[model samples]
Target: MKKNIPIFRTGDTIEVQVWVSEGSKRRIQLFEGIVISKRNRNFNFSFCVRKISNGDAIERVFHINSYNIGNVVIKKRGDVRKSKLYYLRNRIGKSAKIKELLTKK
Candidate 1:
């Protein structure tokens, strides 16, 4: 399999566009969220995204090399120490926020 992965760390905000099939027609759907964790293991590489919808926390995992995914755009990088952000699951409101990492040019 060809490698075409984006360089995004856990805790970053990203948007994933995926192809959705509805009946005979197919369309691209956008799923935007913060990266909670990344399961990197060669071909089975996948990432989990978390977002608050309708006042409820929603999480979705997507495969890195899946054909169904159209795009994965990173919006912001975060300053975090852990590889898995499972602790964010317990956070709510303002407490669930992750600090943004600033890179100097």
Candidate 2:
């Protein structure tokens, strides 16, 4: 049986809550980053996230239908030119940044 998974697209800023196991205890960790790339349109889909951590750029890929994921929250929508923001990897400081979409009041 195929389970219905939540739909997520590229160029979206998402907050992923993942379950982490430490020793005999388990906890949920929150990771807030921008979606740089997405692959596989089916249940075996996965997406990559990029975030600057401690003066270093860190990128992580998460499965869309993984049980370890607690929740996926969209923070802000962005306007991007390409499907993959791989160019951002070569940039730093202000050059590697993405503009936020402002809504009209």
Off by over 4 Å in 2: 1-6, 102-105
Query: Which residues of candidate 1, in runs, are more than 4 Å off?
Result: 2-4
**TM-score, candidate number 1:** 0.92
Per-candidate TM equals: 0.92, 0.85
lDDT of 1 by residue, 1-105 (tens): 535557888999999998999999999999989999999896678899999988899999998778899888898899999989999899898899999999999
Q: How displaced is residue 8 in candidate 1, in Å?
A: 0.7
Cα displacement (angstroms), candidate 2, residue 80, comes to: 0.5
Best by lDDT: 1
| Residue 69 miss distance in model 2 (angstroms) | 0.6
Q: Ten-residue segment with the worst summed lDDT in candidate 1?
A: 1-10
